[model samples]
Structures are given as structure tokens and as C-alpha cells.
Target: MHIVIIGVGGVGGYFGGKISNSNQKVTLIARGKHLEAIQKKGLQVKSINGDFITHPFLATDRIDIVEKADLVLICTKSWQVPEAAELVKPILKEDTIVIPLQNGADNAEKVSTVLGVKHVLGGLCRIYSKIEAPGVISHFGHQPDVVFGELDKSKTNRLQKVKEVFDQAGFNNSISGDIEVDIWSKFMFITTVSGLGALTRVTIGEMYENKGTRHVLEQTATEIYKVGIAKGVSLPEDIVDRIMTFIGKQPYESTASMQRDIMEGRPSELDNFNGFIVKEGIKAEVLTPVNTFIHSCLQPMEAKARI
Candidate 1:
């Protein structure tokens, strides 16, 4: 099976490296210094589970150069998915499976708008990781978990095949029975903390330590939950509590990639995360005051960063 990975940052690099090491025909599509580093040396992954290096069958920025791809993992940022979809469209074969492991609720929708439904899958990953260097991924926190399935949430042979590949790669994974709920479940948790993390400029531990801050987290998650439930996602009633417990388990110094991007004066998923909840809330007639507040606070910086 030939697997192609787009945007080889933390998510793509770590998972793609593992798949490549499993001896699959893996191709990495990346650009700039990271691509240079991988082309010269191999992709390096430093993980808590263990460290390993993998030289993919091919690593190039040009998608057209890839002769064939059976599976394409779109690991780009939420906002970049559409553009990535455009670039990788030329390489999509008859049976190529494109799964997006971005940290947002609507990533699959974004990709499908460009690549069509047959080639798209809804997926999300849970891991506190980032690019430690060019072509190097650092998995410093979280037991990396991946959840994915067909957009329609049907049982199929393709789903099982994808699961087998993930099993071989050796990370924690599940073929979600209801991928929408799974995607929103991760979205609820990530959106609950990500915007607040950026606004407060505090680590996950710092926010969890403050009683008042913790209250805000609850409010944020609750607002997001209402929006998701209103949109017919059927998230559990105890989702906020469950997410709070999950946040408590994160490393003391852990910060989400979106939060780190904002802190470093880089463009972030402000629109895709908090801003997304705000938009969806409006569409669903669900109140999202807390999310609106967070989005409002960060819009200027986000706009400036884009400039």
C-alpha cells in the first residue's frame, strides 16, 4: 500500500514516520527546510513511547511527483485543508483514501468540498506534539490516539483495512462508530481549552490550577457542547466533565499547537476553533457567549499575524 502524508508537522511526521517504519510504501509531501532535512537525512521522531527514524519511500514537495497513493493523510491546519486538497487532487487514484487528522470539527467537510465525498474520511488525533526542528517531531505529551471513520458512519471493508494499517503503525487508534460524534468530542475538548489557552497565555496546568479559570473552562465547554448538540451531534451530557478530567491529565507545560502559534505571532486556527463554534452557534441558534468573547479577544492578533 502506498501512503502519502501531506503537511508533515507533528501529526503527519510522527504517524507517517511510524507507518513508513512499518515498511509500507510511504511518501511524505512537505516543503522548505523540513523537506530539505527529510530528503537529506530521515524524518526523526522523538516520542515518550520510544524514538525511531524513518526514511519514507519518497519525500518531496511536489504532489505530482508521487506516482500513486493508496492512502493520503491530510495533516495540515484546519484552514490549510482546502488548499492542501487542491494540491493533492492531482495524485488521487481510484481507491486512494484521504483522511484528515486535523484538530477541528469540520475538517472532513472542508476536504470533501474539494475532493468529493468518496475520497474523504473524518478523522482526528489527540497528541501534544509539535515540530521540534526541521524534519523532527517531538511527542512530549499525551498517549497519542486517533479516531477515524467514513463520513457516513457506515461499516465497510475499507474502514477495517485502515484500522489494520493503524494497528501495524502501533499507536492507540479506534475506528469510530459515529465519527461525527468522535470528531465533535475531540473538538469540544480542544476548542474548550485552545482559545482560552491563547487568550490567557497560560499552560494547561496553570489553567487547571485556578478555580476561576476552571469555571471559565467549564463555561467554554458547555457553550461548545450546546452548539454541537444543537447541530445534531448527540454529545453526551457529561462531556464537559469528561473533558475537564482529560485536561487535568495533560502535562503541566503542555500547550496546544494553535495556542503556541498565536503566542509566537504566527497565524492560528482562531477562526477555525473558537470562531467556528461562534459561527455554528449562530447557525444552530445556540448561545455561545464565552466562545464569542474568546474569539473577539483574539481576532485582532489573529488578523495582525495574518498580515
Candidate 2:
């Protein structure tokens, strides 16, 4: 099966590089210095497990160069989804499935609205990774797990075929019967961690170590969970406990991708993360003080980065 990965940053670079290493038909869409580096020196991934490089892999800046891929993984930031969708529309056939491995809940829906719902798949990715430098990706912690399914929770041959390819590529993948719940679960955790971490300027470990800060973190998670429940997403009852436990076990210095972006003065997914919650909360009449505060703190920073 042919696969095209749009926005070859952390999530796309790691997964695409893995598929390329397995000698699969994979093409990566990237731009700027990173694209130039991959075109010249190939894509490299540095992980705690091991490091591998894939030279001479298919890398291009033009989406038209890759057409009719069996699966197209949209790994760009949430804000970039519309532009990416418009650019890749012509490359999609009737059977082409576009999996959005992006944060926030609205990306898949937004992209699908533009490109047609039948052609879009809702997907979520779990990994601590980033483009450490040009041509290089760093996996800081956690195994890479990708979950996806049809928006309406129906199974199809296309999803199965995509699953088979991912299985062949040796990835932790799942076809969720209810991808909406899965996406919300991930959003709950991410918004809590990223909001608190970016606001505090500390890693997960440091944030959880302090009693007061840990309480604030839990409050943040509770607020997000409340918002999710109000929005009719079936979150697990013990999700807060589970998240706290996960936080205790995670790497102390680990930070959210959003937090990292904020620290580096890069455009962040704040609107998709905490800001998303705030918008939903207003609609649902759910008060989200913690998220509101985080959003307020980062708005100025994000504005500066855009300039």
C-alpha cells in the first residue's frame, strides 16, 4: 500500500521514517530546511530504543508528486489542516482515506468538511517526539501508538487495509470502534499537561513534584474532564486517577509538545488545546478557570511568535 505523510514533523517523520525503513512505499511531504536536509542527507530518527537513518526515501515538497495514496496521514498542526486539505484534495481518489494524526477534536471534522467525510479518518497519535534538528527526529519517551477509525465508528475495508500496512510496519495501532471518545481522552490529558506545563515553565516531573502545583494540575484535568463529559463524550470515570498515576510514572523532565513549542517561540496549538476547552465550556456552560488562565497566559506569547 502506498502511504503519503503530510507535514513531516515529529509525528509524521517518526512514523514515515519507520515505514520507509521497512522498505514500504512511503512518501514524505515537508518544507524549508528540514525538507532540504531530508532531500540531501535523508531522514534520521534518534530514539532511546535505537537510531536509524533512511536515505534515498521519497521526500518532496510538492503534494502533486504523490497522488492516489492508499492512506494519507495528515500530521500537520491543527491550524494548518485547512490549507493542507486544500492542497492535497486533488491527490485524493474516491477510495483514498485521509487520517488526521493531529491534536484536538475538530481537525478531522474540519478537514472532512472540506475534503468530504467519506475520505477522512479520525486518528490519534501517542508519542513524545520532535524534530530535534534538520533531518533528525527525537523520541523522548513513550511508545508510539496510533489509533484511528471511521468518524461514525463503522468498520470498512479501507481501514482494515491501512491497519494491515501499519502492522507490517511494526507499529502499535488500533481501529477504535468509537474514535470520538478516544480523541477526547487524549485531548483531556494533553490539554491538562500542556496547559499546566507551558504556564509553569516546568516539566511534568517538576510540576507533579510540588504539592500545590500537582493540585493545580489535577484541577486542570478535572476541569477538562468536566468539559468533555458536558460535551457528551464518554470518558472513563476513573480517568483523573489514571492520569495522575500516569503522571507519576512518566519521565520527570518530559514536556508537552505544545509546551516545547511555546518555550521555543514557535506557533503553538493553544487554540486547539486549552483554548478549545474554553470555547466548548462556554457553549456547555461549564466553567474552566484553569484552562482560561492558561490560554490567557499563552495568547501574548503565541501572538509574538506569529509576528
Candidate 3:
């Protein structure tokens, strides 16, 4: 199968690098110094599981030349999903399968708005990795797992084919029973930590260890849970508690990708994370005061980054 990985950041780089080791053809859409480095020196993955390097069949910034793909993995930030979809639209074959393995809850929906629902799938990834340098990805923690399925949850031949590809590539992947619930479970956790972590400008340990910030964190998760429930996602009643337990087990130095983006003064998923929850809350008649506060507080920085 031919696969194109868009936005070769932490998620894309790691997974794409893994797939490159297999017999399947792989192309990576990347940008700036990262793309340059990948084209010249190959993509390097320093993984907790192991370290390896593989040069893809092609790595380019041009979306047009990647005119055909059996599968397209959208790994861009949540806010960029629609833009990415538009860029990749002409390249999609009728049978092309696109999965948004992004942090935001509505990335698949956002892509569907551009590429149509028939071409999109729901996907979420569990990994904490980042670009350590140009063309170099560092997987510092967590066993990387990619969960995905058709939006309608149908068990189809194509779905099995995608799963087989990942399995062949030696990735820990599974077809989710309920992709929506799986996406929300990830959204609830990432959104809970991201905004507060960005605002406080602290590591996860520092944010949770401080009494005041811990309260904010809890409230943030609460707001997300309320919004998810209002939106009819099958988020469990104990999701917030479960997330807290998960957070507690995380390494103290751990931080979210959105938090890192904001701290580094890059454009972030602020709109897609807290801002998304706030908007959905209003639509669902759910109160998301904590998210609203975080969104408001971070707006200036977010705006300035774009400038």
C-alpha cells in the first residue's frame, strides 16, 4: 500500500518511520528544515522501544506531487485539519482512507468538511514524542499506540488492510470499538492538562503539585467531561477520575504537545483544545467556565504567535 503522512511532526515522524521499515511504499509531507533534513539524511526515530532510521521513498513539501495514496494520515494540529484536507483533496482516490491522528476531538469532522465524510476515519494516537532536531524524532515515553476505525464502526476489508499494514510495520495498533469514545477519552485527558499547563507555564508535576493549579486542572477536566456528556459522546462518568489517575502515573517531567507549542511561542491547538470545548459548551448548553477562562487567558499569546 502507498501511504502519505502529512505533517511529519512527532506523531507522523515516529509512525511514518516505523512504516518505512516495512515493504509498503511511504511518502512524507513535511516542511522547512525538517523536510530538508529528512530528504538529505533520512528520518531518525529515537524511540523508547528502540532507535532506527529509514529514508522514505519521498519526503517533500509539495502536496500536489503526492497525487495518489492508498492511505493518508493527517497528523497536523487540530486547527490545521481543514487546511490539510484541502491540500490533500486532489490527491485522494475514491477509495483513499484518511485518518486524523490528532489531538482535538473534532479533527475527523473538520477534515470531513473538506474531503467529505466518506473519505475520513476517526483516529487517535497515544504517544509522547517530539522533534528533537531537524529530521530527528525523540520518543521519550509511553508505548506508542494508534487506535483507529471507520466513523461508522463498520468492520470492512479496507479497515483490516490498514490494520494489517500497521501490524506489518510492528506498531501497536487496534481498531477501536467506538472511535468517538476513543477520541473523546484522549481529548478529555489532553485538553485537561494542555491549557492549564500552557497558562501556568509549568511541567505537569509542578502544575499538579501546586494546590491552586491543581484545582484549575480538576475544573478543566470537569468542564470537558460536562461538554462531552452534553454532546452525547459516551464519556464515562468516572472519566475525570480515571484521567487523574493516569496523570498521577505519568512522569513528573511530562508535558503536553500543546503546552510545549505555546511555551515555545509557536501557533498551538489553543482554539481546538480549550476554545473548542468552550464553543461546544455554549452549543450544548453546558457550562465550561474553566475552559473559557483558559481560552481567554491564552488568546493574546495565541494571536501574537500568528502575527
lDDT by residue for model 1 (226-267), tens: 998888887989988999998898888888889999999999
* Pick by lDDT: 2 or 3, better one: 3
**Model 2: colliding residue pairs:** none
Task: Give the worst 10-residue stretch by lDDT in candidate 3.
Answer: 242-251
**What's the distance in Å from true for residue 266, model 3?**
0.9
Name model 3 segments beyond 4 Å from true.
Answer: none
Write model 3 residue lDDT over 145-234, tens digit each, in one string: 999988887887888989988998998999988899889988988998999999988888888788888888889988888888888888
**Model 2 poorest 10 in a row by lDDT:** 55-64
Better of 1 and 3 by TM-score: 1
- lDDT of model 1 at position 83: 96
- How does each model score on TM-score? 0.98, 0.96, 0.97
Query: Once model 1 is optimally superposed onto the true structure by TM-score, how far is the C-alpha of residue 78 displaced, in angstroms?
Result: 0.5
In model 2, what lDDT does residue 104 have? 86
Q: Which RMSD values do the candidates have, in order?
A: 0.9, 1.3, 1.2
lDDT of 2 at 290: 84
lDDT of 3 at 57: 90
List the global CA lDDT of all models: 0.91, 0.87, 0.91
Give the backbone clash total of model 2.
Answer: 0
